[model samples]
Target: MKIGIEAQRIFRANKHGMDFVVLETIRELQKIDQKNEYYIFVSPGEDKCLEESKNFHIIEINCPTYPLWEQIAFPRIVSKVKLDLLHCTSNTAPLYCKVPLILTLHDIIFLEPKQNDNKSWYQNMGRFYRRIIVPRILPHCKKIITVSYFERNRIQQTLQLPEEQIIAIYNGYSKHFKKIKEPREITSKYIQAKEYLFFLGNTDPKKNTPRTLKAYSLYLKYSDKKLPLLIADLKEDIINDILRKQKIEEIKPYLFYPGYIPNKDLPYLYNGAFAFLYTSLRESFGIPMLEAMACGTPVITSNTSAMPEIAGEGGILITPTSEEEIANIILELEKNSNFYQQQVAYGLQRVQNFSWKNTAQSLLNLYRQTVTS
Candidate 1:
């Protein structure tokens, strides 16, 4: 069978959750399946991360815009390929796709209320695009894949889709995420601190950066140990604005905002960190927590969303809205050595259940089932 997978943004330099999901899953599929012909479609990008194997083809489509790439150029190319199935690894897919469509809707956060009025032109445009495209394309989808059961339920209830139409498949972190022997060599490029709390924050409101900063402030105010906070992917100016609004400017000196930490250096950052803060207000799946856990770092994540389910019996869970709850957990982890060690162990064990191989195998099985049935 011929399969066409839309891995449009995976080749981009700064990859996010969905990009890695497509990249890792395809890599695993290449390892496991050699019989079927696989066509991996992507826009022209500088990072040519994925290579073409005998059965697997990396087709780079040159288009100026995402809409044009997917809407205009994509269909023209795939229409000629005569694919048995087409899997779009992102939330939006071509409305006029001819073959059986499989869409990985990571989350319906854009469809949810009180969303971040993101100032980013690219992000807001993407959200608007999803809002317009998702409802139209969902009905045509043969199978809809989501990152977690929580998100699956949301898609069902909110979108009014049948349960069988949507299925939950967990995402996995990279194997490179495990504990580093010595992280300082790589981490020194970002910060000189021997130990610090690592938070991956952005201007996105769901990341709950303002409240997390407030919680860190409380930790510094109350606790004797005032370990500095190192935040990644967030600009210095934006962070200062958030801190200023939260009235936690006192914590500025303790902040290490190098901004936009390279994805390659993430494991090193996790290895050198005292703890990983992943207290997002909502997440379909919290892969960063697993990444931190896999790195032998204790993750302080929110009790909400799929985090508790994914956290699997370990790591610190706090009420995302409560800064005091977040602050107390941070302090406790620092004060109690035994508890911290136990968390590290729990993280390592929890990660065993998730892997890119598992995700790819599930997808491969789904592909066969859909094409046969």
Candidate 2:
């Protein structure tokens, strides 16, 4: 079988959930299967992360914008390759493609009602693009893939698609994420404190940054020992704006903004941190929660969406909206060493259920099935 994978943003310097998922799966597939030939379609990027294997081929497509790239240039390239089946790793796919299509619709967040809040132009544009493309491409796709069961149900109900058509394949964290010995060397370079709470945040509204900052402020007010927050991928200006809007300027003293931390150094950060906080409002799959667990770091995430399903009994679950609850969890974890250790143990055990090898095998099966059918 000749398989084509649309990993448009995989080569980009800053990779997110979907990009990493596709890349890791491809790498795993390379190791396991040499029977089928694979082609990875990507835009030009600085990071040449994936090496070309005997069965895998990397094709670079250049376009001015994402829409033109995916909608126009991508299909043209795939048509020439004569792929038996094409897997669109990202949520949106080309409206018109020659080969049988399998789409990994990570989340249908855009299909939900729009929030009347300030959002970046890039965020709004991407949402708008997905809104237009997803419906058009769904009927054309042979199978639909999602990251979590919660999202699978949501996509089925929202899109009114048959249950069997959409399959939930859980995402896996990289093996590189584990308890790092002598983590101070990594932490000392990024942050001032020897110990601090870690949170990965960005401009995305779903990240729930404003609420997290409010919760951290409450934690500082009540706890006897005030631990500084080490935030990654968040700009100082954005943090200040959120703090100002939430009227939690006092959190500035206990805040450490490291801007953006690379994926390679994340395990050390997780190992050195007192705890990892990921109380996002909604997520299809909380990859960070799994990464934290894999590193043997205690996590505090929201009970909503797929977070509970991912965290299970592994980490502390709290309501995303309740700043009080989030704050209390921090204090509780700090005060009780037994609970923290237990959470870490549970997480380490739970993480064993997921791996890139499993994900790759499932996808490989899907590709063969799609081609044969």
TM-score of each: 0.98, 0.98
lDDT of 2 by residue, 292-313 (tens): 9988889999999898988885
Candidate 1 residues lying further than 4 Å off, grouped into runs, are none
lDDT of 1 at 12: 90
**lDDT tens per residue, model 1, 1-373:** 9999999998899888889999999999999999999999999889989999999999889999999999999999999999999999899999897889999999988887755557777778888899999999999999999998888898899989989999998898899998898999998988888999999998888999989999999999888878999999999889878888898888899999888777899999999999999999999998898899899999999898888889875557899999999999989998999999999899899889999999999999999999998
lDDT of each: 0.91, 0.90
Question: At residue 182, what lDDT does model 1 achieve?
Answer: 95
* Candidate 2 error regions (>4 Å): none
